[model samples]
Target: MAMHTLIKEKGISGINVHDWTVLSHKTSILNSQEIDNATNELGIPIPEMIFGNNFLSIEHKSGFKLEFKALPALAMVDQSSKSSDLIKVSYAREWFEKRSMANQEHITDVVKPYDWTYSTKYNGTNLSTDKSLVFSPTTSESIDIEQLKKPDPILFYDENILFEDELADNGTAVLTTKVRVMPSCFFILLRFFLRVDDVLFRIYDTRIYHRFGTNTVIRECSTRESSYRETRSRIPRSKGGDLSLLLDSNWVSSQLPEKESQVEVLTLSQA
Candidate 1:
């Protein structure tokens, strides 16, 4: 897979800032050739649905940039090992054995050192042409959930999946990125949601918020997890509850039992 040589055609949509542009692109899922190319390059089965051509980026006039793309994100996945993020699902072996015999072509059989869950802790990527522009840890400011809930007029909004898989009907692992632009600011959420039928529920989220007329961006990342039974027992059978709600990433994200968060801030002029 000579991934660097592959060409993809896409059109971008963007919002202009004084010195930079907030841009995003959406494109169709990869084709057979592209899938094989990616799989061979990554040394693992490509995801069931991979939008290799889709991306979101902040491009600056001075060539400073930060971008998110599928391949680089997946590159962060822990290649399964004794010390790695190994498969925690006990029945994973049985599922893989059964899947290998059914002529399933969408995914290839996993060799050793593979994380079947494909849980990636990706927090986006930096493609900054300038080396000095970087996000620095901060304790003074954070993303404002209340401000974002004010019902401001939305100028642009979009959500796209980086990749997803159904774990042979046992559960699901999906990574999705969403962005919303309002009259005053724009917010971005990149989430990885994983559910193992009877084992656990995990959510890793990244929130990036920038209020217009400011040179600073606030990014907060959090991780939440709960045992399957514990998560199920919390359901109250209302709009925000139900056994089926377990499958809803948004719903489950709200119900998770624990959270650990980290915050960082970046100024438009990092130098």
Candidate 2:
């Protein structure tokens, strides 16, 4: 397949932070037996065995292409955190000042090295080496309000409901107000810090939604109904864990569908 470039669009605003530790080349934790133990415990399956020189060719339906190198012994922390007041202000200033520069640079178009992995459903299960990261730059040709959907409650109230007509007409009217629940949205950016033994690596991911988009709004929409529904939690570790390091079938499955369907049919027939 022809290699495609990944572009990250500019003027996209968000916040995230992370720290990571990289493992040394001679780390014992990376031994075959140790990796196998982790995979077995996690119930992960190995799908395609890749060599050191193989490049994962990623193509987006939107006509973008990505090629990246997968590195070993890297750690990543992908999370969102509150930024310092001064840092926030400086970021805003930098954003405005570099808006044009960002547009021209089109960071999304650059293809960087990404560590890739697959989820158990796809029959691949390794933790450290199984996790993959891809840096694709995206462009926003138009404002995507849908991207800003958030899960929060919004309240609106009236300011002038309690004052009499005489008092309201004579001076500034005093009004009573109540909270009105509405939909709201917000965006979150995650910075993954990978820790492999003693070495660290960093990767970034962004989750975005509307400023006033709320869970209520998501529930009301048929398209977002599934999001409101609950499901079994798969996270094994809640603290000090690298979610990005976990296998992601969605990423791999998205890439090689033609072969996957054939394999699925065969498995179903045997079952």
Candidate 3:
């Protein structure tokens, strides 16, 4: 229930981007009503496997905590778009088991999440004049801990769209895209976005968090970080719809789990 402090161990500390805590020791089942509601809101079907009792819950310090219930939507996109540029990334339990056979092999070797063409505009005028706007597996450069914290060099490819929502009091919503891949602890990657309020005051998020192990297990444990950039103009309506831009966000890779923390003690239930 306690959160670890944001230490300056890496020499990149100004604004704390993320802090995480493991909130679930076991999974819980979901009723039909919960599934139905989520489906209606997301415009996608919720998977049955997500209701399994064996689940993991995590809380982000500055961001949103991604639970098991949010995985399916975040991991797979609705196949409505016929554009070939849009790609979907999927994973299975076997992917994690095989990775145990080797060390130094990374998940990115096989799958790179958040592959898309990016374009930025201000008042309908393109702003990304210096660099290539496309971001994908082939174009993505390998990132380290330092790169994850800073806002420059533009590591990951992201996109944002604004829409009108009658249910929203502000009448407008913005969705900003992001993706992450973790092969070492959990063999999973998720490409999802956050629906922020008109003025960027509130956030509704969905993310992918994978679970592994049969008898005894230690799930993937790591911290995530991100930086943001605000719009220069005061009149968002005249300039552009978005109020803030996600400079970059990613998991901390340099840190490792403690030996004691990696082991678990469990009690079995009699059938």
Each prediction's TM-score versus the true structure = 0.82, 0.17, 0.23
Residue-level lDDT tens digits of model 2 in 1-271? 1122222234111111111111101111234654465445434321222121222222222222222211221112011232122222423443233444536443232222322212011111123221222222333222234543443443221111111112112111111111122233222111121111111111222221222211111100000001000111233456355444223323322222131111110000010
Stretches off by above 4 angstroms in model 3 are 1-20, 52-76, 79-271
All candidates in order of lDDT, best leading: 1, 3, 2
User: Mind giving the per-residue lDDT tens digits that candidate 1 earns over 1-271?
Assistant: 1111112335667666445567778888999999999998898776788999888876666566777788887887777563122333434543354455655532223444766777787898978777776788999988888989898876667787888888767588888888877767779899999987766788999888888667787889899987776788878857565478888888888989656889998777632
Instruction: Compute the lDDT for candidate 2.
Output: 0.22
For model 2, what is the alpha-carbon lDDT of residue 138?
30
The CA-based lDDT of model 3 is what?
0.27
Leading candidate by TM-score: 1
Best candidate, lDDT-wise? 1
TM-score, cand. 1 vs. native: 0.82
CA error at residue 97 for candidate 2, angstroms? 43
- Which parts of model 2 are misplaced by more than 4 Å? 1-138, 141-184, 213-271
Model 3 agreement with the true structure over 73-120: per-residue lDDT tens digits: 223433344321211122222233334444535444533322211111
Candidate 2's displacement at residue 200, Å, is 3.0
